[model samples]
Target: MIELNDVHKHFGPKTVLHGVNLTIPKGESMVVIGGSGTGKSVLLKCILGLMTPDAGTILLDGQDVARAERDAFLARFGMLFQGAALFDSLPVWQNVAFRLLRGSLARPKLEAREIAIEKLRRVGLKPDVADLYPAELSGGMQKRVGLARAIAAEPEIIFFDEPTTGLDPIMAGVINELIREIVVEMGATAMTITHDMSSVRAIADKVAMLHDGIIQWTGPVAEMDASPDPYVDQFIHGRAEGPIEAVR
Candidate 1:
């Protein structure tokens, strides 16, 4: 459903993505794994139109993303930010319903709240939690809230950024399961960028290793462990040696 062909992006004199190419099929999850400063965020931002690539093309369902209408293009996608990114002052329900309450998806406040509550339930949250502020919730609760918001609009595509970054292992596992289930239940095309190996196993059908500003290796998740690529090996096994140089 999504394709990137020889995509390149640079900052000043530094090139981040060097002719990166990737494909994500419809209704499947693709996880891109990379260490910090490897330009995963840059690749994502370029695809989302947050930043324009210096060259090459990105297509969504065969339509050029760069030439597509911004609002309409964005309407087909949902995002869960790394930080949860809730409105500090709004109640949880309002936060989840933010997109539904404005712009093209606007609905009556009551109806939006009802949909938000339902989405929260899908993410294993109770309706009673809706009235609380983000500050009142635990990290796990906050992540669930963010997940609820991401699916509230029922977008055909979803992007998850470091979905298990800060939570404890158990909670991270919960989040991963929720993500895997939701993507399957909703049949949404998912692209996730994370360094967490647990998340890759739980949420991905296919995995790609990004290094040196390109896709170094990619294959079905089941084959990731046995892949002979040194970069993929170093990353999945958490090896300090190999092709990847650990920063001191």
Candidate 2:
């Protein structure tokens, strides 16, 4: 459903992605694992057209995303940002229905609210919580609300950024399971970038390891442990003595 061919991106004197090539099949969950500053987020932004690549092509469902209509192209995607990134001024339901209440995807406010509530329920949130603000919720609750908002529009593709970051192990596990369940239930193509190995295990069908701005390994999650690549080995095991150099 998504393909990147020899993708390259550079910022000034720094190169972030160097010929990234990856293909994600329809309804597959592909999780990208990499150390910090390894261009995982940049790769995502390139795919989403938030930052245009200096070289190569990104195709979504066989069409070049660069040439597609911006609004229409974006309508097919949903993203759960690293920190949930909720709007402080909006209530939970409105935040969840933000896309539904505006633009070409817009629906009546009442209808949007109903859909928001349903989505919240899908993410294990109660309907009463929809009336609360982001500040009123716990960190885990905020993540669930963010997730509810992500799927509220029923997008064909979902991107999750650092889905398990900044949560307790138990809460992270819950979020991970929720993400896996929602993606499978919706049968949506998913791409996630996280350093959390637990999340990769929970949510990935296939795993790709990025290092030095290139994919060091790509395979089924089951094979990740046995992979021969030193970078992959170092990353998955959190070993400091492998080929990956730790910054002092």
Clashing pairs in 1: none
Each prediction's Cα lDDT score?
0.95, 0.95
- lDDT (Cα) of model 1: 0.95
User: Across residues 99-173, which tens digit of lDDT does each residue of candidate 1 receive?
Assistant: 999999999999999999999999999999999999999999999999999999999999998999899999999
lDDT of 2 by residue, 124-198 (tens): 999999999999999999999999999999999999999989999999999999999999999999999999999
Pairs of residues at least 3 apart in sequence or in different chains that clash in candidate 2:
none
The 10-residue segment of model 1 with minimum total lDDT is: 77-86
What TM-score would each prediction reach against the true structure?
0.98, 0.98
